[model samples]
Target: MTSAPPLAPSFDAARALRQARETFDIEAAAVAGLKNRLTDAFSRSVQLMLEVRGRVVVMGMGKSGHIGRKIAATLASTGTPAMFVHPGEASHGDLGMIQVNDVVVAISNSGESGEITVLLPVLKRQGVPLIAITGGLQSTLARHATEVLDGGVDKEACPLNLAPTASTTAQLALGDALAVALLDARGFKAEDFARSHPGGALGRKLLTHVSDVMRSGEDVPRVAPDTAFGDMMREMSAKGGITAVVDAHQQVLGVFTDGDLRRLIENGIDLRTKCAKDVMHLRPRSIRPDALAVDAAELMEEHRITCVLVVESDGSLVGMVHIGDLMRAKVI
Candidate 1:
């Protein structure tokens, strides 16, 4: 018989919980320490980035490289033009991606990654400003950088204290601080952020105006208030489920929906001769054409209605937006 496989270690729930809590406490303390360390150098780094004619080129090695990628993405999304460049890749041929007008943010806990140190001279030669984020004040990266933002941690959360834990946490927090500071300095607005993030729900809420999604012109089922109930039913059928009861000037007097028809039929009203004004819902909910699609959704949900009239400033009906349209536009 083959030798039996070694037994796995027994599970220890208490030990696992203790270890997780210890890790969280250590990382939290590391991030908290950064508050006292924000110095004039941090401000200068933000100014340097603001003045950069080109992108912020972030570089690091190993774990720092991973954190650097996230920092670059945060910077880019928050109005700063930033990209991550692996130091090893820089030596191979990617250094060409960096330009003299760009600001380079070099991250290294020890500040002695050979891959990054090796490219320092090249960056210097190109006149690129270097901002260093490192755990050591006297590290090689700190010495060569134009500005230094200390990302030091008291100790690692790792049991062996060898794996990067608290140090990376501090670095990531510092990177976020930098991105937010730059965003504020640039006066970046919510609409600007929405423009960059147009694929998500938040973007739709901010960027989609009512006119863009509302059914307008002839597609809007509009009937005069004096219209006979038979003609009103035809208008509702042709327009889907509802019709705008308006005057000759296209000013919405009221709205007639399928629900209203059901109530009328239940009240034993004769559909053949009665007029739309006799059974229309007066003071129906209306939204301006310039309002956000999200606003329309809110109104529909609040009133428990399926559609709302889009009107101009003068109370004239301009369009109609249905719940189905909002759903198709992913605004609901």
Candidate 2:
């Protein structure tokens, strides 16, 4: 058999990177263009959302549906109650999700998506306000909307100029802008965001209290200020690292950590005769039980300590938290 010629490399890494950059540049420009187009329509959408007694129901088809779902999540997380419904599914009974008090945000690049346009009359008859995000202001979707926000793009990022690229980017940016406006108007704070996302790391950092992760009750290593150093060592070892040295009233006087023990040993102090009060570090770093876990972590990091005592406002030790506890809680 005759030998076949070696095939040339089919992949061009440089060209691929150049094409990706081009796509990003096009979309960036599209989003940037939306800044100058911000008008009364944008304000009207925000006002409608702010006044909504019901959820913001977002509807779109194809790629717009994907973007709409993200927009809905952003709105819901940022303090606005919102949800996305596929327009095709809405016609098949999902329309029931829309209530008269809800504001409908219908997205269609051409404003002529059959799946979305067909529901316009039903939505209007139900007395629901419709906000259209479309490239063509004169499109059918825009004509039916109570308010219209132009999401027009000069061109698609696709070389063929057919794919929903730049237009979707504009829609996503506009949706984010609306969500932020609503968030500011509502005075939504980080605590509110943490409440909405209690399962995420940010929630843990912002919402997890010192009491939630502190070692409490008998698990908290503690000793009286006059306790023998040997006895304090036993308590610290039993509890695995540090012990709070408290007074007669169970008020924390100081903390004796493993580092303190090492320092005492280096100084050749008699461990059996020395008292905890003689070797403990006074006014040790501490946090309140109600403080955020992240705050505890920050205190520990700032002092280069491994553990902190959780105390009451009156300096009574209630619990103890270690760096490991914060790490395990994902608050670090």
For each candidate in the order shown, give its overall lDDT on alpha carbons. 0.94, 0.93
Query: Where does model 2 exceed 4 Å of error?
Result: 1-9
- Name the lDDT of candidate 2: 0.93
Worst 10 residues of 1 by lDDT: 269-278
Q: How far is candidate 1 from the true structure (C-alpha RMSD, Å)?
A: 2.5
Best by lDDT: 1
The residue ranges of model 1 lying beyond 4 angstroms of the native Cα positions read 1-7, 266-268
Model 2, 1-332: lDDT tens per residue?
99999997899999999999999999999999988887899999999999999999999999999999999999999999999999999999999999999999999899999999999999999999999999989999999999999999999999999999999999999999999999999999999999999999889988899999999999999999888877888999999689998987879999888888788779987777789888888889999999999999999889899899999999998999999998998897
CA-only RMSD, every prediction = 2.5, 3.6
Candidate 1 local lDDT, residue 27: 97
- Provide TM-scores for the models: 0.93, 0.95
Query: Can you write out model 1's per-residue Cα lDDT over 152-186, one digit (the tens) per residue?
Result: 99999999999999999999999999999999999
Q: After superposition, how far is residue 88 of candidate 1 from its true place, in Å?
A: 0.8
